[model samples]
Target: MLIVTTLIACILAVLFIRLSFGVIRLRRQYRVGLGSGGVDDLERAIRAQANFAEYVPIALILMACLELNGAPLWLIAILGIAFVAGRLIHAKGINQPPPHFSNRVIGMKFTITTLIVLVVFNLAWLLLQLWK
Candidate 1:
């Protein structure tokens, strides 16, 4: 069972819904149907949602693979937690004004680090299986 991945995916799903609704709310407020309507907040909201959509699926896939391949439960939990926390921080940072760049940087660091680790771990596991 993909317990860790399931939990992480659920959390990500909720965050995604929140980000999506944020875009919708901004669109309604700005009266733009197709784009940000030249509104900065709306633009930020759109990008936040778009960025989340762009990064999450593959992360979840990698995480699920790790779990399915019998990676350590603790490692999976840590990675999942880091990814979720990173996404939350990034969403908050991206939605804020320009002064909060650190949040974005830190968040991306966590997210990217998690991805790299997942990739390495998955690759190592696959190689080990092949060698066996």
Candidate 2:
């Protein structure tokens, strides 16, 4: 059931682990065990990690469910790629010492676009299935 989802999940997991490493590296550098310790760079790292944690799971779950429900392979791949690119770009942007607005904005744009597409596509598919 999760064949395609599993494939996408692996790619996402790599990205997630990378983000986790960035957070861990920053944490050790700042010597803070919990929270940001009032360090802005550490805070930004934490935020980037937190932001990814908040968004990627929901997108992945939606993608996995859609694939299980028989969504097209191409659709799943496209969405998965876009979602990953979004997070990568977002993390790269926000991981900067002072935070880069352009990258962050573009990254968020991709994320929101992916989410909207997933929500609409999944809901429409579900409704069509119910109609049948």
Candidate 3:
């Protein structure tokens, strides 16, 4: 069972829903049906949600694979927590006005780092299994 991945996915789903609502609220406020309607806040909100959508699926997949392959639960939990923290921080940073670079940078660093670690772990596991 992908317990860690499932929990992480649920948390991410809720965050995604929150981000979606943010976009919906912005759209309603700006009164635009399609696109951002030339509104900066709407554009940011849209991108924040879209960005989350873009990054999360693959992360979850890799995490699930790691868990299924018998990766340590503690490691899985750490990576999952880091990824979630990254997304939340990134969303918060992107949703803010000007000078939000630091949070965005730090968030991406965490996200990318987690991804790299997962990829390495998965590949290593695969290689180990193949050799065995």
**What TM-score fits each model?**
0.95, 0.93, 0.96
Q: What is the lDDT of candidate 3?
A: 0.94
Q: Which of the numbered candidates is closest to the native, going by highest TM-score? A: 3
lDDT, ranked from best to worst = 3, 1, 2
Question: Deviation in angstroms for 76 in model 2?
Answer: 0.8
Tens digits of lDDT, candidate 1, 1-132: 999999999999999999999999989988999988899999999988998998899999999999999889899999999999999999999999763789988889989999999999999998987899
**Candidate rank order under TM-score:** 3, 1, 2
RMSD of each: 1.1, 1.2, 0.9
Q: In model 2, what are the clashing residue pairs, if there are any?
A: none
What are the per-model numbers of colliding residue pairs?
A: 0, 0, 0
Worst window of 10 by summed lDDT in candidate 3? 98-107
List of clashing residue pairs for candidate 3: none
lDDT of each: 0.92, 0.89, 0.94
lDDT of 3 by residue, 1-132 (tens): 999999999999999999999999998888999999899999999999998999999999999999999889999999999999999899999999873988888888989999999999999988998899
Compute the lDDT of residue 99 as modeled in candidate 1.
30
